[model samples]
Target chain A: MNASSLPRWIDIGLLPVLNLIAALTVAGVIIAIIGENPFVAMGVMIKGAFVYDGALGYTLFYTTNFIFTGLAVAVAFHAMLFNIGGEGQAMIGGLGVGLVVLFLDSVLPPLLVVILAVPAAAAFGAVWGVIPGWLQARRGSHIVITTIMFNFIASSIMVWLLAGMLMAPGQMSPETRSFADGINLPLVYEVLQMAGFSVSRSPLNLSFVIALLACFGVWYLIWRTKLGYIIRATGHSERATIYAGHDPAKIIMLVMAISGALAGMMSLNEILGVQQRVILNFTSGYGFTGIAVALMGRNHPIGIVLASLLFGALYQGGAELDFEFQTITREMVLMIQGLIILFSGALAYLFMPAVVRIYSSLRKPTGSG
Target chain B: MADLWLQFVLTIDATLRVATPLILCAMAGLFSERSGIIDISLEGKMLMSAFAAASMAALTGSPLLGLAGGILVSVALSLIHGFACVTHKGNQVISGLAINILASGLTVTLGIALFAQGGQTPFLNKSERFTDIVLPFAEQAEHVPVLGTIYKEIISGHNLLVWVALFSVIVTGYVVFRTTFGLRLRAVGEKPEAVDSAGGSVSGLRFQAVIIAGVLCGIAGTYLSTAHGAGFIREMAAGKGYIALAALIFGKWRPVPALLACLMFGFMEALAARLQGVEIPVIGNISTDLILVLPYFLTVILLAGFIGKASPPRSIGVPYIKER
Candidate 1:
């Protein structure tokens, strides 16, 4: 069965849903192996992610980071680049944010400092990404290997800076001192309280708003811009892109820069919105998680947002599962995440032939063909 | 001078110990990548095997059983990679990445559930682990001069797996360059369509390559848990799989060169361990963290053609779909 002949809804919607189910089923089997009721765990996870007080905020807070990183991966995907350095880019972005806030908080207005810090993150991330991009473009280095190498290098750099120069004086932990009062992004509950409404506090902050805006911006840039067309063209066929008299190498670097910038913006949600300081390993594995989100979302902005929410819910609920069950730990979430990537990204088309056959049969009754 | 020689010999010994896993993994990667399959999941397979090996050794009190378990688990993973890439024509990198992530998470999750030791297996006793094998006459040779010192310090005292690692390299070199199967493997990787035209099964050869990779990685993982260390710790493979991949690229995907690359990296790590908190005369204190980054940095530089070109197989990363 030809995959292209499928309806758009089935292509985008049904396929992903089926893939997700397949992943969950595998995860369910693992849970059962560990002597837990999969259905009970699922119920617990849903309630913990959505039904509990303040859970929604925490889920959204996680979602904000995913959105930025997902968009980062999505942008690179359009250019046929697998930018796995989002983890490193985001870490460097946090460093950029940290430097700006640290230096300017005492001199500049808080708002100005915050505004400047935003671009600082993007610039740092772009620089981290561009080196690999440039290497791949000019030197014929494979971007995948270079990006993976950069992640390790980024990790080393972060450890060096945080433990040495960036470490807060008089403290043992490898983290920068907190930013000055009012320098941090406004938390969602705090904003709501200022507007005369009482709400439970969570880490969800204005970065969530920024993340939504980034989604819109990505949608506009990819669908409504010439650069998007060029990126997609390069991804579809670099030869065709060359035949069109445009430089695919330049497009690759530019797309990587954009991807890096999007990845960098994740620091806004993590550092500025939550931690208010640069910390060791602040990016966690969110950057890698973005790959799963992008693949599952099919590189679409709306799909990314939805995928990000699902992951966010999983993360928040996984934490709850860790707390509620004796055998279950947070690592189960990581396992589930791996299964999702396996199903949605690697074995993505495993069920496609079967789906195509079923759909064709339903559409054309009594047709042997 | 004698003291300095001793230090150097010890460092070389450490290099051998450290390079064992890297050499094994690089050889593993060589088999897979030379067959036009990009295997980034070497780390995951190694980690899972390490866990399996440690658990088996801990349970059965036999290193051989542990090695068997490790190989079994790794071969299973390799088959999955084959199923995805060969059967489903999925993205090879994604499959590798998923396996890696899954192994990482599953190891810890199972560790916690099974042992309740916070994702660590109980340390194996010497009886249950691969203890160092002192070479014959090493005690008598210890008192002799330079050659005897070299024999005792540099050549002796490594576990059986170190020898296995060295032997595996020789085997890999011969099999990859000297055999008909190797010729077919290289042909399939370079041009699967041509192989298909010649009535050879591209998928079958690729599957064989990955399975060979799995066996090598399994031995590497077993060496890690049972020989290099006493038992499995969470993320015990760490980034050795990646470092091995880098070494494979650095060596231009050849067995002997990849072994040399692994040794170089292992030497760097040994030197880093020695250099921790030690200030140099002119360069001042070199951070151990920075030293850890050197292998990756060098690989990137090498890949960028600062040193030499490292070309991969032409049909690498592209699944072979037979024309209807």
Candidate 2:
């Protein structure tokens, strides 16, 4: 039984679900080893992430960041480029947002400042992304190595800028001054209250809407556009893409640019909507987590959405675990996440051989009958 | 002139200390990449080793035991990576990334579980660490100028692991360039099928290379915790592993050149650390961030062919599937 012989639904959906189960089962064992009931932990996590009023909003807030980063990674995956520099690109994007807001906040209206900030962020991210793309295309430098290097360079750049030029005047921390109230993006709770829904206040903001739109945009671009066709072709085989009269280098650059832009947009959620100020290490590990999300999602936009939600639940629930349990700390949450990544990614097909055999056996009788 | 000499000596001393881990990591990367297994998990392996070494040193008050524990953990990780990628034919990069993520999380989790100092091990005493060894008659040597000063300043005082790290480079060079194992390892990386056809086991060679990487990275991690610092801190390896990867590439996967690259990075780092509060003629108090970014920028430049071309192993990152 071959991978291709598996039904599309099983290939796309069932396997991922099974992998999720495997990951969770492993996580359950770890929790058990920590002297905690896995079932109680799971229940607490699920309730904390979704069931409670304000918890949903917090979950969505995290989901928004993942959506952008996952999409970024997914787009790059289409071109066979591993943009591990999403963390760096997003950091630089936040810098762009910081520069734009710092200079334009007092000068322009809040609406116009936000309108300008989006493109500024995306453009900075695209530049950062394209450098490695250009290096790969022109110099034959491996994209993975260059991008990883860029992450460190980006960190140093952020630290330098935040501490020197962008620091709040007279402040010591590596963060910028807060934006004016008028310049701050409205929260989702505030917007919902305006609509009379009485939602709990959380950090969820307008960026969630942008994240959704970006997802749809990515789906349309990747599935419906000629450029995406070329990108996918290049990913399939550069020689085949070249035979088809497409420039693989151009496709690589374009794919990387779009991917970087998507990664950059994550700062809209972190900086403009939530913090209202640029800070050091604001991207946290969202950029790297995107790799796991993309892998689990199989690099499909719809799958990415589901994967993002799942991770968002984990993030929120993990926080709850830290707060509620004495034994299960935040690091334990990371351990669980790492286990999930390992199973879903490195061991993605660990169960596939068995599943394929089962499917073949089921179909054999059906066909004969 | 004396002040200049003192400054140079201090920079060289700092560079040696800083470059120790990088040298080990680059050699580790060289072994892995040469054998066609892209080991991005160098960081993870080092981190896990650092944590294990620190914890063991703290527990037993024996740096040697800590070093052994570190090596054991890293070898286990290396075997896991080999099992996944070499045996199951998993994605090499993904396996590496998964190891990294696992190490990042497990180290912290285990730290909290054991000592509960928010993911930090207790500091080791001087006796429990690989203390710096001073040369005999160093005070007498300091009385002499030039060569004696050089001996006193640059060569006399360094931890045993620093000497071990330096010696490992020569050993790595000889093993990689002069031995039958080196030839087979290189052959497996570039053309595994040819090696396999010639009665060499590709998986076996690759697994051995990975084990070598594990041992080297383990020593690097132990050096970080036991010799370079008092104990383990969260993410102490930081991006040094990645930097080592970059150095490996910049050196074109060669041991000597990679060691040079590591030294260059170490110098840049030493400069960055030393430049604090210092005013230059035109730059006038250069930002540490810019200085910090210099090594990566240099790596990028070197990788982009401004310095030299970096040709990776032909079959690197490709899983070797036995065609039966």
Candidate 3:
């Protein structure tokens, strides 16, 4: 039986769930190897992610970053491009956000500064991303290798600027001065309070709203727009796209720019909403995590949102697990993440033959009955 | 003038020391990529091997045991890469990325669990690590003039692993270009169907290439932990794997050119280390941070055809699906 002949639920929902279970099972074995009870750990993680006070807010805060980055990866995936430089793009985007707030917060209104910073961040990230895209399209450079190189270059650039010029006065750490007063996005707790609904304080902010908007925007752009058609066409077959008289190179560069812009928006959540300063390594492997989220989400906006929430829970819960267990640390989340990527992204179809076999056999018996 | 010459010599010496791992890794990448397997997980494998090497050395007080342990761990990872890319026919890049992430997380997690020192293994003493081996007549040559100074300062007193790195390049050059297996490996990368027609198992040959890569990366990782440094710290690979990948591209994926590229990057790093806080006549103080970006920046430029073209294996990154 053809694998694609499976039911929609099996293809889109059941398969991913099964893969997630496979990843979790492997993670459980690892936890056991480290002298911890996997079931107890899972319970603690669940409680920490949802049951604890203010945990949902923390999870949502993390979910916002993943949404931005997952969308970034998904957009590139539609164009058959892998923009792995999201970490660098986000860092540069934070720099743009920092520069704007630092220069304009006192001179201009806070809202105006933020309005300008969004495009500025996108533009900076686009420049970082489009260079590699252009190289891939025109110069025939491999996007993966160039993007990886660009990541290193971005890190070095960040270290240089932060340590030398951006370093706050009288501070030894490599970070910029905090943004001007009132420059922050509204925290979710405060927003809830304003609406007469009390909630515990967490880092969740108005950026979460922007992340949702971006998702809606991406869904519309990818599924409904003519440009999205061209991008998907280019991904399907560049030769066919060329036969249709569209310039695939231009499409590649444009899609990468958009992808980079989405990645760049992550800074709004981290820098403008939470940290309020451009700090060293603030992206903190979130860009890479975006790859897993995008893969597990199957590059759909709705799937990405759900996947982001799952990862957000894992991240929040993993922190709690670290505090509860002597052997397990926050790195345990990273291990689980790797396992998820392995099972979902790389070995996604490892169990497909068995699944198809079982599905066909069960369906045949039911149909005969 | 004498002092400046000594400084130059010392910088070259530093270049040799720093370039050893890059040389080894470039060779490893050469084997993997030439055989049509994209091995971006080179960093992950080396990092994991470094942790394993450090842990074993700390436990057993033997550098040899550490080297074996490192190689064993690295080969196991290479097998996983093989299973994903070859057996499952998965996205080669994603599989490599997954392994890299897995290694990065697993190393730190296991390190914390085993040693409880905040993701660091116990430091090794001289007996547990590969110390510098002084060449014969080093003291006698040091007393001689310019020629003697060059011999003693530039050539003598490197760890055993450094020589192994150099030797590995020669072996790689011979094995890649001269042997029948090398010819089959190259053929599989470029045209797997042709090799298939010739009754050669493409996957089998590719697996051998990845295993060779694994061994070289293992040696590189062991060199890092037991020879270059005392123990494993978190992320001890520190982008060296990526740099070596760049060097491989910069060298156009050949053994000798890749070694030279590694040396060039090593020289830049050595110069950066020496030039920190040193003011020049016009440029003033050149930031080491910018200098560190040179190799990556150069690779991008090279890839962009600003200098030369870097043509990879034709069938690279494409999974071979046997035609029905």
Q: Which regions of candidate 3 are displaced past 4 Å?
A: A366-369
State which docking tier applies to candidate 3.
high
Q: What DockQ do the predictions score, one after another?
A: 0.86, 0.66, 0.82
For B68-106, candidate 2 gives per-residue lDDT tens digits of: 999999999999889888887887887888888888888
Global lDDT for candidate 3?
A: 0.92
lDDT sort, best first: 1, 3, 2
Q: Name the 10 consecutive residues with the lowest summed lDDT in model 3 chain B.
A: B145-154
Best by lDDT: 1
Candidate 1 per-residue lDDT over residues B1-324, each given as its tens digit: 988788888889899999999999999998899889999999999999999999999999999999999999999999999999988899999999999999989999888877888888889999998999999999999999988989998899999989999999999989989999898898888999989999999999999999999998999999999988999999899899999999999999899999999999999999898889988899999999998999999999999999989999889999999998
Instruction: Tell me the deviation in Å of residue B286 in model 3.
Output: 1.1
Clashing pairs in 1: none
lDDT of 2 by residue, A1-369 (tens): 677877798888888888889878987886777578999999999998999879999999999999999999999999889888899999999989989999989988999999899888899899889999999988888899899899998898888878887889989898999986677668989988999989888999988899999989999998998877888889999998899998899888888888888888889999988898999999998998888889999998888888999989888888898888876776666777777777788778888889988878877876841
Q: Give me the runs in candidate 1 sitting further than 4 Å from their true place.
A: A366-369
